[model samples]
Target: MSALLEADALHLRFGAVRALDDVAVSIWPGEVVAIVGESGSGKSTLLRVLSGQVAPDAGGVRYAGAEVHALGEAQRRRLMCTDWGYVHQNARDGLRMGVSAGGNIGERLMAAGTRHYGAIRDAAAEWMVKVELDPARMDDRPGMFSGGMQQRLQIARCLVTQPKLVFMDEPTGGLDVSVQARLLDLLRRLVGELGLAAFFLTHDIAAARLLAHRILVMRHGRVVEEGLADRVLDDPRHPYTQLLVSSVLAA
Candidate 1:
């Protein structure tokens, strides 16, 4: 099967700091790949570049078969609204806080040209249940929800359109430890049920272990290790990767 998303030899720099240096990645349909790294390690930058939110200074990104960076802004936006989904690390960035939860999900359906109000609402309610959110609270605004609830709402909004590929940046970050595990479980179930291709950035090795089939360990704008998630984490080859594992264990 062809890769659902592909990035090769990516190079991006901000002043003297290289955000990405000769990075390459690919995701197959129904497969999940996690990019794991510390802060400023370029995992998030790579995600943005792959999602077309930021254009790389060099190299190529293709989704399905189209050249991602070459597409017009409107085309890229349209692709995001329809075929691709992005879950922000912060729920606030991905959702309109003022809108009710149902409306948030409905908006994606609307973007896809769904005109029937009943159908949109029904789909929204169904997704709310799927994400472990109460459909009864669909009328509540994100600001009225807890942090975990807000994050789940953001996810519902993303998946409502049944995107083929989803890019998630630290989806389980910035949450209480207890909540993170539940959210990760929900994400794993959703990804499996939908058979979606996923690329996510995370510092939580446990999250990567639970969700990703493959893992990429990054440092200083380059991928230092790549392999099956278990192999990379169990017997990390690079000294940096080994340090990452040891640090997790020491915590």
Candidate 2:
């Protein structure tokens, strides 16, 4: 499969601390790729660089053959709204707390050029059901919902646009284990059913194992190992990766 997104020779720095160095990666259409590492290992920084949220000091990112940094601000914003989705570690970062749940979902549809009120609401409601949220709660504000519910609402808002690619950062980070498991299951199903290409960043090896087809292991701002998820996680060659896998298994 051709790469839907690609990053080459990425380098970034923050006050003498290297956030990323000589990194290269790609995400194919309908593929789920995870970046796993300990905190401050540059996993999140690489996600930002690839998704156009942050500009790298050096290197380039291309999405569907278009140079991301070369696009105008308006074009980049439009691409994000239309063809790409980003799910932040915190639901609040991706959701509009003041808007009604349905309104939030409808906003994306509207941005995608769906102006009909009835059609917007219908699509929002359908997405709510698909994400396992009750349509009856469509009028409620995100603050009225639980953490898990808010995350689900956020996912619904993003997927309602039917974006070709989605970027997720520590998607289940703050949830309880049970909640995380359920959310992961839901996410796995939705990504498969929609054939969405995803770039997932998480420190949780279990989450990576559950949801990623391929895994990239990072340490100190460099990719230490990468391969099919099961193979890399089960038989990691790098010391950092072996430690990561062992720690998860021992937990």
Candidate 3:
């Protein structure tokens, strides 16, 4: 099968800083790929470029047979709303604080032309339960929920539309250890159940190991290592990757 998303020779810069250099990426349907690196390593920048949130200076990206950069503003927005899901590190950024939790998930359905109120509400409630949230809390505002709950709600909102590809940036960031573990477990199960193709951006090797089938290690805006998750982590070839794994071991 052709790649669900494919990019070749990506290069991006932010003035004097090089955010991406000769980067390439590919994800097939139902495949989970993780990008891992330290802060300022361009992990998040690579994700932004692939998801069409940021334009690469010299590169081409194709998603579902369409050239991403060539898409019009309205076309891009429509694709983002209906076919793609992005989970921000901060739930507040991805969520609508002004609306109820159910409303947030239902909004995606509405964008997809689902008009019946009952159907929207029912789908929202079911997703809430799937993400381990209480269905009874559907009417609560995101701000009223705890940080972990809000993150789970954000996930439900993203996944309710059943998008084939999801871009998740540190979904478990800033949560308590127990909460993070619980959230990771929930995410793992949901990804399997939904057969999602996902890009998981994380600094935590363990988290990547738990969710990703393949791993890419980045440093200085370039991918230094790429392979099956187990092979890369177990016998890392690149010096940077070896150091990364050793540092995690030392910790």
- lDDT of model 1 at position 77: 90
Candidate 1 C-alpha RMSD relative to the actual structure: 1.0
Task: Please give the CA lDDT of all the candidate structures.
Answer: 0.95, 0.93, 0.94
Candidate 3 off by > 4 Å: 249-251
Clashing pairs in 3: none
TM-score (all chains, Cα) for each model: 0.98, 0.98, 0.98
Q: Rank the candidates by lDDT, best first.
A: 1, 3, 2
Q: CA lDDT of 52 in candidate 2? A: 90
Per-residue accuracy of model 2 over 1-251 as CA lDDT, tens digit each? 68898989999999888999899999999999999999999999999889898999999999988999889999999999999999988999999999999999999999988999999999999999998999999999999999998999999999998999999999999998888998999999999999999999998888898899999999889999999999998788999998888886555
C-alpha RMSD of each candidate structure in angstroms: 1.0, 0.9, 1.1
Residue pair clashes in candidate 2: none
Report the C-alpha lDDT of model 3 over 178-210, residue by residue, as the tens digit: 999999999999999999999999988999899
